[model samples]
Structure formats: C-alpha cells, structure tokens
Target: MAYECLFTSPRCVFFTFTLLNQLLPSILGATYHSHDVTSDTVCNRYHKRELQVYMSDPVILETRPESAHMLTLGLSLSCTFEMEAKGFYTTGVVSVVQSMNFRSHGDNCLDYMQTIYEDEDNDMKLKRKKSKKKKILKKVVKAAVLSRRRRDTDDEDGRGPRICGRVLFGLQVDENETLPPPFADPLPPTKPDQGVLSSLFWDAPNPYQSLVSDAAEVDHKGEIKTRLHISNRMLRQNEDVNLKVVYTAYQECDGRRVPESLFHCGYGLCISRSLVNDGLVNCPFGDCADEVDCASAKEANIIAKVLHYERTDETSVWWIILWVLVGLVLMFLACCGGIFLFMRRRKH
Candidate 1:
C-alpha cells in the first residue's frame, strides 16, 4: 500500500531500522515490559484507507563520489490503530546505526610490477627496484595507519557525535483511531561518522555495541511490544545493502503512573525531562513549551555576575594604584620644596 506522509506531501522513501524496547524511559515510569505481538494489531493508512504495515528490506542505493553526502533515507508511515484510545497514546521509535568502511586502494606490488613490465630492458635494475619498493611500501603503510589511528582516537574522544541532518518521521494517527491531542516526538541521538582517512586506514568501532546502559525489562500484561537491535555497517557506493527491519507495536499506558522526570504537554502527552531545554520543539502546540524558560536564564545570570565581579575587581585595583602613585608624587614634591627652603635659609 502507498503510505502518505502525515506532516507533508507524500514521498516514496523507505527506511528500515530496529525498534528499541521503550522509546521514552522518562515518560513511562514503570520498567519496560514487552507485550505479545499476536494479540495486538498494527495498521498503516494510505489515502484514508487502512492496510497492514509491510516491509521491504535490503533496499540498495548506489552513491557516487559527488553525491554521497546528500543522500538521506526517510520513511513515512501513517499508523492507524484498530482500537480506540482509552486515556492513553501510542508512540514508536526506530534507532538506526550507519557505519562506513574504507577499502584500501592502490596495491604497491601491482604498481611496481606494471613499472617493471614497462622497462623490459632493465632486468638487473628491476630486481633492485622490487626489493627496495617492498621495504618502502611496508614502512609507508605502517606509518600512515598509525598516524590515522591516533588522529581518529583523538577526534572521537574530543568531540561528541555529529548530526548531519534532522530526521522527521513519526506516526500520524487519526483522531478517531487514537488520542485527540497530537504529540511530537523528540529527536533521538544519531551517529553519523563521515571520516575518510579514519575509515580508510583504521578499523572502525563495532556498530552493534550499545552506548546506553544494559537495562532489560520483561513483557507486562495489557502491553503489546517487541524489541530489536539493528547494526548498519560498512556503507559504500554501489554496494547491495540489506537493512534488517523488526516490528513492535506500541504499548498503551495509563496516565496514573507518570514519572517525576516527565513534563506534561497540555492535555495528554508527557515529555521526558532530558528532552526539555534541548533547543528542539517537542510539543505540537505553542512555541516550544519545553524549551521555554529553561536553565539557560540561570546560566546567563551566573555568567553576568562573574563578568561584573571581574570588572569591579579590575576597576578597584586600578583606582588603588592611581591613588598610591599620586600620593608618592605629592610626597616627593613636598620633600624637594623643604630641601629648597632649608638651602635658602642657610644661604641667607
């Protein structure tokens, strides 16, 4: 079925990623519990018609040298619930990990062999060149790889993950099928490593390694959910890539057991505390309610006080120095006048 975009015009871009256990840990206070997928039914909408969510895996796109940076994967699915929203809402989050592996190019032996073939008359010289070239190539490779590893390690440690582009894809459930209020999904953390030298010369980190803490939860009753982990590694141009897609229907939670770290978004939705003041709009209504009146004001006040203290201290020191200099000059002038008078009296 043709899935139409809920936020904007429909586009035929598909992405596949694994849906994690509990999307919003802070919003849902209770420990994450997976639900039976057999009992729950998840459906997607196209042209106001309901259809089952289908999967098209391993979609390959060959990226050329000039246009690799501009490529983005977007998937829009309008999920329509089979049941009514009984004082609860459903949200789904998919985590994607993209890894690029660099293949070493230009074999030194092959280039040397080609050079030897060109100069067929120099048999003795070819043997000497071959022996010298092998030793030089090994040293060059070792030095380059070592330098690259050091640089890559420093870069990873010094800086946080770089976000290349914003990802905007979420479920747009109809009011009849879901809740009345429309909730906004906060931007999840993404890792976009676009290092040419590091990927080429050094081994990349394991993509499957979880950066988050190890916290697992069992399936709770009245909740239908599934957990999946996907690793997207070694992305290259003209390569047939297969993305593993795992499906997990969202769980319905009563608003009774709300966590202390959650911020209410007007009528129904609860946003995580970490998502607040993150400089992104997490609510559909009002001008970024979560970001408004954040700790930035307090920080700015503290900074202003520090600057004021520094300025006051500097001004006070300058005034004290000026006064001391003035007093010393006055004392020296008085001493000179007294000496002049004494000399005049003695001369008289």
Candidate 2:
C-alpha cells in the first residue's frame, strides 16, 4: 500500500531529478532531480559517426571540442542519444568531467554532492561511483577477463571485448581532443615566465598583465558565443586609464577551480584580452578621406547611445508605505472595538 501511494503521489514520480516532493523540504526552493541528457548534448549531424578517442584526454577548448559537447558512455555512445538531457560525470586523475548543451550540468552535480554532506554525518558521504547502470558491472568484469586472454591469441579472431577507451574502430572521432605535455601535445615550450598564461586559462582569480611571450590575438566579432569573462559595470564607468581583459576557462569538474592542466585550445601560453567596447573592433577596412570623423555631432550621438538606458524599474517604496498605513488603521479599529465590547460586558 505504501509503495502504491508513493507512485500515486506526484512527489515520487520524476523522469530524471526534476522532482518536487511534498514530504521533503527543498534547499532554497531548488529541487535536486536527475535529468536525462544525450540527444540534447549534441546535434543530429553526428548521428552516424563513431569516434575513437583516448581516455583521459583533456577536452579541447578552442572551436568547441566535439568531445566537450557530446554526452556518452560506452553503451550510450553505441546507441543513439535517447534523452533530452542528463547529469552523468566521469572521474579522472586530476578532474571529474561534466558536459551538457543548454544548462550547467557541472554546477548542478556539484550542488547535489554538497547536499549529501549537509547531513553532518561523515559516514553517509558518497564513495566514488563505478557503474552507470545495473548491467554494466558485469560487462566491465567480462572486458577485464577478455583483456587478460588477448595476450595469447594475437588479437585476431576471438580475443575479447575490444573496447578502446573512447570508442571502437571507424567511429566518429572528435579532433578537438586535448593532449597535454609529456606526450608531445603541441604547445609553446614553457619557460620560467611562461606559467603566467596558465592562470589566465585556468581558474586564476585575476588576469595576468604584462604578457611578453604570447602576442598573437584573435578578436572575433559575433563568432565566439561562449563568453568566458563578463566585465563589471564599475570597470566600464570608472574610465580607468587602461583596463585589462582577462580570459578564463571553466574546470571540467567545477566551474570554480583552476584546472591543473588544460587540453588543446590551439596555442599554448597565449595571452588573451577580452574585448568589450565596440571601438576596439571597429577598425574599418577602407581609404583615408572616406572615414567619418568622430570629432563631430555624429560622435556625440554615439556617445549618447552608450550612456543611454532604455528601461526603468517600475517598483516604488511609496506603495509599501501606503499598505503599511492601511494595515495599522485596521489594527487600531479592531482594538477600539474590542475595548467597547469589554466595557459593555462590564456594565451588563
């Protein structure tokens, strides 16, 4: 009966983790629910492709690595993406990985992990999870057993489960797999001062100024969609003599931490500055006299537009004051009526 009631109630019925339980108190109105992520992670263009990529490879950053975008496991990778979204993570030597399309799957996972510790009992914490489903545990053991036999058979007809960590042969390979140093990943050889760019790309709190080694820059207009750093209003209004732009990278495990090492983003030790003002990218490719001089009224209109604000907040404190006054008046009337009734009872 209890089990039947659980399913009947909306609280217990959830697709992934998008559940609202009547019996449980949610933290800050945020409910922890499991979401299925697969099809939602990648586009349909990669439907037929199978990719063989190395395990433990860093996700490529520049040009948006295919591995970074797609969500898959060995079985899920084999099958077409079945769901809209999901929240599965992988464990690595230096990082735990999370990937998704529209939403922040990483922080959602981290927040869920934090909820586990809220119990205050240390024993209740999660150990590393090994299996994605009930059945995979058996396949993993079988694969291990097969791996041992591969040494004797010459790996031709009947060796074992040939599960290359990424995928099988002729599968879609994401070229943006990040290979780091010690294995000859193409990066500018690091000098003593070369460590500066590390902070910029990693989770360093501030941007590194005075870059000497990395000078080449890519100022993209409407090309780069994922904005790394957003400038504060103070930086824009203060009009500092020179404001520096800091480009940052999100950690695969958590968006907060500075990655110990980053995968391929094309150039290593590249000093990058975030471009904010349109003026920085407004270099018109033309002749000498054709350029409109910005020293006139046209420049004034441009300046005016920058300073102009189109929207105004509608709320005002006067409404609150009026409501409070009405509440006090009603309370006073109730008190006077109570006193009159008490006097009439005493007289009677």
Candidate 3:
C-alpha cells in the first residue's frame, strides 16, 4: 500500500528525498537528482512565485535524540495538490529535503549545513554504540555459560578451562583483554570439623598449642542439646545534630545494647523473641541492665535499639597503642621461647 504525506511532515519529505543516492549522507549541490523533484519544485517556475505555506506545520514530527533539549528542525521542499484548511486546489505535491543555508562562498553556509549534518551523524553514532554494548554483554553471558559447561567436564585444570568465542565486530580488534579468572573451588565448603564458642574465647598459655574446641552435642544428663545461635549486631551511632531535639521537643531513649552486658547479667527483658533461648550471639556485651520483670523495659530497649544504638558508655574499640605494645612484648617473648627450645634440643 502507498503511504500519503501532508505538507507539514518534514521527516517524510527528507526521507523521501535522501533515498536517491543509494544510502549516503546528503551533499550540498543543485545537480543532485532526487525522486522528490518532479512536477512540484520548491521554486515554482511556471507561476513565477515564492512557495506558499498553505497551512500550519505538519501535525506530527519526531524530534531526534529523545533527551535532546534543543529542537532541530528538518526542512522539506514539496508542492501541493489540494491545500486543505487554507483552501487551495492544486494538481501535484512536491517532496524534497530543503537546506537553510543562505550564502554561497563561505562558512555561513557550511556552519548551518554542519549543524544539521552533525546532529544526524551523532544520532546514528549513539545508536551504533548502544547496539555494540548490547552485543558485547550478550557475548560475555554466552562465554560464561560455555565456560561453566567446560569446567563441569574438566577438573585437571585446577583453574577451570576458559570458554572463548570471537567478537564479530570490535573497536579494538587486536587489543587482548583477557577474560576474568574462574571462580575458586570453595575450601571443601569448610564443614566446620569442630564448632566455635562465640561467648567463651580461647585463652591459651602455650604459644604453639593448637587451640582445642569442645562442643557437646548432648548435655550431661543425655538430654538433646538445642543450642540456638543468637546474633546481635550493635551499632552505636551518636548524632551531633541535636537530632532528638529537632525530631521532638523532649529527648528520647537512644538505643544502646551491650551483648556482653546482657551475657554478664545472665537474665534480661527479651528485646527479640528470636534471642529468647538463642545460644549464640556474634557480638557480645560486657554487662546489661538486669531485668526486674519490668513491662516497660522490653519496650524501652527495643525503641532505643531500632531508633539507633547510641551507647552512653564505651563499647568496642581497637586501640593502636595497646596493640603495638602487645605485639612488641609478644615478639620479645617469642624470641626467648625459641632460644629455650633450641637449647633444650641441643642438650638432648
């Protein structure tokens, strides 16, 4: 079916006109023969008159580069048959791409033409770039899948065998960027041959002693041991912005939980039912306020923690000086210990 165009449609006119040169960017010249220059021309020779804009611009025209803030208008040259709305009856319609350049010799023409040219050129460039990126991503995904399949077949390559495919077209053909290393075999999944006690730390007197950890699967009475690990994360963030005053006229309870404190106290109001009988907590506090069967304490502690745990007292800190001193002392002792062991071995 043949599609018809109105006088207002500049795009249809440009598209119709540019198809003449076997798909090349249009050049500025009068000799260019196009399908658009038929019985209707921009300059009417027979009537000896300037073209009449029979009506307002076309009803719909797409602006290039959707996010383009500036409007780039394309001009089309065409003659009309029957100009409706303005009411004129003509025999034919002209469809040709028209340029806005006025001067002939210098850059004024070049600059105007360049503006239109570059806009279209850049639009095509961006489209090509997006298509290229999508292709690269698809290739990467395919390579990964192929690599996984290859690895599943071969174990001799401790590092999994690489899967490779050619990138059909690329900006840098010879630039060899290697694929990322394959995923490492996860430490035989660390089945945890022995369990660790979070609350009770190992304090060994022997420097070379491998710390022994004993976890009872069953209690002394032979009852089934149900130990739940309760992880309590503490974040004591103090806001300097008098934020409490900003949020409300009076001050509220800032959340400050000491896991070690709770452990030291042994019993407290349950902040979370998850921690009720939970045997383990990742972060332990030194001491916590003892629960006196107080109803409000549970509510108060919860509100404080959720709002933001801000402790009035010192919590966890890694002291640089303390660690340095400890390290130096340990080094000196280690040297002495090594000397003693060597002397004993020599005597034997």
Identify the candidate with maximal TM-score. Answer: 1
User: Which candidate ranks first by lDDT, i.e. highest?
Assistant: 1
Residue 114, candidate 1: how far off, in angstroms?
A: 55
- Residue by residue across 1-348, what tens digits does model 1's lDDT show? 122221112221111111211222223322211111111122223311111211111011112243222222322122212211111233322111111122222421100000000112277455646676355544555454344321122132222122111111111122232312222553222232424533432123311122211111111111112221111233345732221111112222224554565554333334444444433333322223444532231122211001011211222364367556755764565566667667777999
Number of backbone collisions per candidate: 1, 13, 15
Task: State how far residue 62 of model 2 sits from its true place (Å).
Answer: 2.9
What C-alpha lDDT, on a 0 to 100 scale, does residue 344 get in candidate 3?
Answer: 71
Off by over 4 Å in 2: 15-61, 64-348
RMSD, each candidate, Å? 29.2, 25.4, 40.3
Estimated TM-score for each candidate: 0.18, 0.13, 0.15
Q: Compared with the true structure, what per-residue lDDT tens digits does model 3 show for residues 197-313?
A: 211211101110111101101011111111111112221244110000000000111134433312111111112222222221111111111222212222233211111111221
- For all candidates in order, the CA lDDT equals 0.26, 0.22, 0.21
Candidate number that wins on lDDT, 1 or 3: 1
Candidate 2 C-alpha lDDT tens digits along 63-138: 1223322222212122221111111221111111111112112322111100000111243222212233524544
Global Cα lDDT for candidate 1: 0.26
